[model samples]
Target: MSITPQSPASPAPYGAWASPISAALVAAGATPLSSLALGPDGDLYWLAGRASEAGRQTLQRRHGARTDEVTPLPLNVRTRVHEYGGGAYAVHGDTVYFSHFADNRLYCRGGDAEAAPFTAPGRQRFADFVVDAARQRLIAVREQHPDDPASHAQPANALCAVGLPGSAAAGAETVLASGHDFYSSPRLSPDGRMLAWLTWDHPRMPWQGTELWLAAVLEGGTLGTPLCIAGGPQESICQPEWAPDGRLYFVSDRSGFWNLYRHRDAGGPADAICPMEAEFGSPHWTFGNAMYGFASAQEIVCTYIDKGVSRLARLDIAGGRLAAIATPYEEIRELRVGRGRGAGFLALLGGSPTIPLELARIDLSSGELEVLAHSIADTPDLGYLSVPQSISYPSASGRTAHAFFYPPANQDMQAPEDSKPPVIVISHGGPTSMTVNTLKLATQFWTSRGFGVLDVNYGGSTGFGRAYRDALQGQWAIVDVEDCIAGAQYLVQHGMADGERLIIRGGSAGGLTTLCALTFHDVFKLGASYYGVSDLKGLDQDSHKFESHYNEYLIAPAPHADALYQARSPINHTDRLARPMIFFQGLDDKVVPPQQSESMVQALKRRGVPVAYVALEGEGHGFRKAENIIRTLEAELYFYQRMFGLPTAGAHAAVEIHNL
Candidate 1:
């Protein structure tokens, strides 16, 4: 539901207008959605972050008309296993097993008992969990950190099983599989005879390549030689699952796009179930991402990405016929296919340009939609919303970059008659993850205030074919920076934005891109980086084991990487930074820690470039606290207004610029 559209009485300066969309409103409405699990008897389970609770993730379930919390306070149901952890919890009947963020220990709840630890409180962390019902244990990807904090930078990863006792296993865990740099998607066959999981080595992220291995579930919770069923160094596989008939099914990108494949017999080559140009899987940034599953033996429910938009469909395994399921969602994050009322259907964590995060169930044959949970409780007036346009433009080095463009939209006001809106070029954090079309209040907050936004899927982003994604290899800063510049230039030339007031912003990997752009080029007048990377050398040393050697692929291998570090790092070349910029950093961020942003700010402050810095306490790589989010948003708005010489009437933040 949206508010009725109305026009204002007169025009005002682009950055000085009175907006109905406030920073607090944006922070309060920006509730993100993640991981979903379904139970038998048509029960719905999912994770929701409360804004008032400082964005603490709570696991909630719906059984019949009753919806209640499964995870109580003081017990944050989250995993630190890859930092951006997903698949943090799973349910088996009325019992639930989850990872406690505070201790990095496994806990078990439900069955009329309070949640208690089942795994020891140590550096060992677990995620991507599945219940091994026959053995009464949990199979998960465990990251074993060294007892010494100094060596904690490197941890050994493996597929291990934890007993389901209500207390710590007394430092006991069965090592089911090991020697892989990373592992995910541990699934068991319906008969519980076979176990399947995906693993990939370092230097090759999960999206670059992975192997699907299957072995017999022997006695003592493990055993049997595992055979490589599908995928290799050249192919990337994701979400290995078992069909009702016990056939191994997974997603593979052998055809340049992630698509569905199935292995019918043991030691036999996997066959493509449905071949298409669209992608059936996304980059493995987080654990427990499922794009498709078995609706029945002959039918499969799935979601595919084409031109940066997601589509849901049903595929007939026998005839190879695919039927599109109509829905308003352009992005489907997590999905589950199970029996509801004894009928097969699909449930998806979905959203659109005008809708917030929603849990929807669609009947397989009827395509009927029933939305179960809305992340944002309040229904915003739709008149002020800016619908995203799927756009692509010619990029540097004769390549193409995709983006979602949202024009300035406001129901109560408009810009001057001849004034073009200021464009904000947003670079998504994942140099590997693609930008999807989902409604975000943070993005809407700017657009509804007469600002255009271009969220770029640069060369290194996923969702496009492998070739386009690989183009970023050995050209991390080069290709990404070029695509961002080209996007702003295109919009300016098309009269969609004012070239003088163009702004660029990004966080994490995107933060590095933003710093690089401001250092080497002068396309935009202002820039902002949220816990951004300013030094390439520091990033490699500060990153986790999952991405310890990622620089080898993004820039260059070591020995040669030393030279690229100096050449690409913005911190080393602050002498070239002339544009005004503001930086937001989390003091506790392990990835791209405080020193990275602090060094850049110190250099820019002394070099006569107008710069402001805001550091928050108890914050991580991304802002989870409501007050910090509100502070950063308000501070950024104030910085932009101050830089543009606009009168700040209701601005709440007062930042000090050393060289303004």
Candidate 2:
């Protein structure tokens, strides 16, 4: 579907802005894309998964053309059955090396057409791996579970190697490095003489701080003493790749925004090839990859967000000239540059409004783009989808906050002539994240059903730049909650929503904002939190490896964690939570344990406050299964309908609403 250029005179509402809305919707629940790797036969491979029933997730191989052909590997092959699976995968000839669930066992897929486990069920946990076809070994980041109490909080992740396409007991895996809290993105140098990877420790997210390490590959296929080549306390390294030349390249957030940086050797500092004020690196919550790719060793093509719009830009590494590559789309995600066979291949989303995500191959020589794959089958007709408009509001501290406002679009279901539609204020997760202008089916689900959505970027979101991202550093619960409240107030003051019927909803971190907003403020009369962090202390203790220390920055350090944790935890302030609330949680959630929600639910029940809690038995941090997604969506909708005395959409599932 093609979008007609929207004129400035006919500016769309914040939610109706085509580009930002579509991008935001697309990014809302996008999984971290595994790094794009080209197979020996030139076939591209990446990890793909979807939300599953009870939030028990599944990750499978997604090849070109056969996107629907998902091969579910054994969930218990490596990690626990309940844990999320599939990180980075490497395909060498007929064999595949990838991470499995729980035990983090490295699995090999080969032989019969059916996928059978090659590695023993209980073994090593692998992060990212590279197939050294010439050496006939798999170079991977192996993580060892810690034993001691203080160290139990930190796992031992190191670079290791093992014989591949062979017996699991053939050779003992050799650890190349140790003492690191986390390890990832192990890339073998082109000449096979060196290796590069990223590592960082406690209290720092990859975006906050990380270091890139490089080492020489020894004659026996082991790594020499690893050296800190680039990255430090102030910079966060992401997606480190070795160029065709011997030089190593990566993305760093040294200059406020994540930009491309290259290093010639392990001695000197990394040079920034492309620098900008927008984020080039997303949070490494999942394993795929991010950033611009090397078109040649000297030229790189990447997607960069500038002023909230994603654009494709070409950078001359040698000359330092950054130029925009014009496309018909306003936003682009998952960029991969493939050379050698043709001009190069890049995966991007083009156009606006009803246009879906399409993979495009760019001809480096001719500067032309060819459509490779389209995500949506049937494109909506013109005027069917509402375009989002960018709106800025003065936040509490006077900083201008960003949000996309979607007007009530379904013509058949207009609001009462005298009153505006009720507004649903959406707070995106990451409090460090931003809302984009991408078309999404989920948002459409609400708008099509007659709700106006105001997706707030709030104070700490990324797209606005570094200062904005750091705004929530110590003010986590406070700033994010206020921004969401301000967003709802903005809608009411603008005559775009009925102030009395305002509702707020968010999941995960967004869910935390939803809960905090409801408890600390009186703006929202009704709210819903999906697997949100109710107790900050519980989150610090129960979260997995990546985010265990995240609260140090969001709230406070460990010993002092109790005071801040108690004060910020919504469960402790049930007396102030007079508004009706609905919560959805995964019983298997390690990020924010089930007890977090259970405590809140029980407290609200005892206090005689209206509340509903639905727990998915086998789920984790987030709901994945299609049935669960549909069920949660419908349940929340039904809860709202009942609370507001609106027309019922049939008899929904009986949720135990407390104090009803």
On TM-score, the leading prediction is 1
Question: What does candidate 1's lDDT look like per residue over 380-479, in tens digits?
Answer: 5776788998889999878988899999876677677888888899998878987877888888878877779999999989888788889899999899
Scored by Cα lDDT, where does model 2 land? 0.70
Q: What is the lDDT for 576 in model 1?
A: 92
Q: How well is each residue in 1-660 modelled by candidate 2, as lDDT tens digits? A: 433334332332222222312322333333323335555444555544433222223333335555432336334222321123334467666556665564455666663455444455443567567877667777777766655545545556677777764544333577777777777778888898988888888778776788888888888777788888777776778888888887888888778888777886635566777566777776665554556677888888888777777877888888878888888776676777768766665654444445555556566767777765454434443444667888888778787778888876643333445656778999998766777777766676567556788988888787666677888887889888888888788889888888888999998899899999989888888999988888887787677777777888888777877888889889789889999999999987877788888888888889998999888877777765656666677677778877877764446544667799
User: Alpha-carbon error at 161 in model 1, in Å?
Assistant: 1.1
Q: What is the C-alpha RMSD of each candidate to the true structure, in Å?
A: 1.8, 5.3
C-alpha TM-scores of all predictions: 0.97, 0.88
* Runs with alpha carbons beyond 4 Å of true place in candidate 2: 1-35, 50-86, 110-114, 146-154, 167-171, 348-353, 365-382
Q: Give candidate 1 misplaced runs (Cα > 4 Å).
A: 1-9, 166-171, 340-342, 649-651
lDDT (CA) for every model shown? 0.85, 0.70
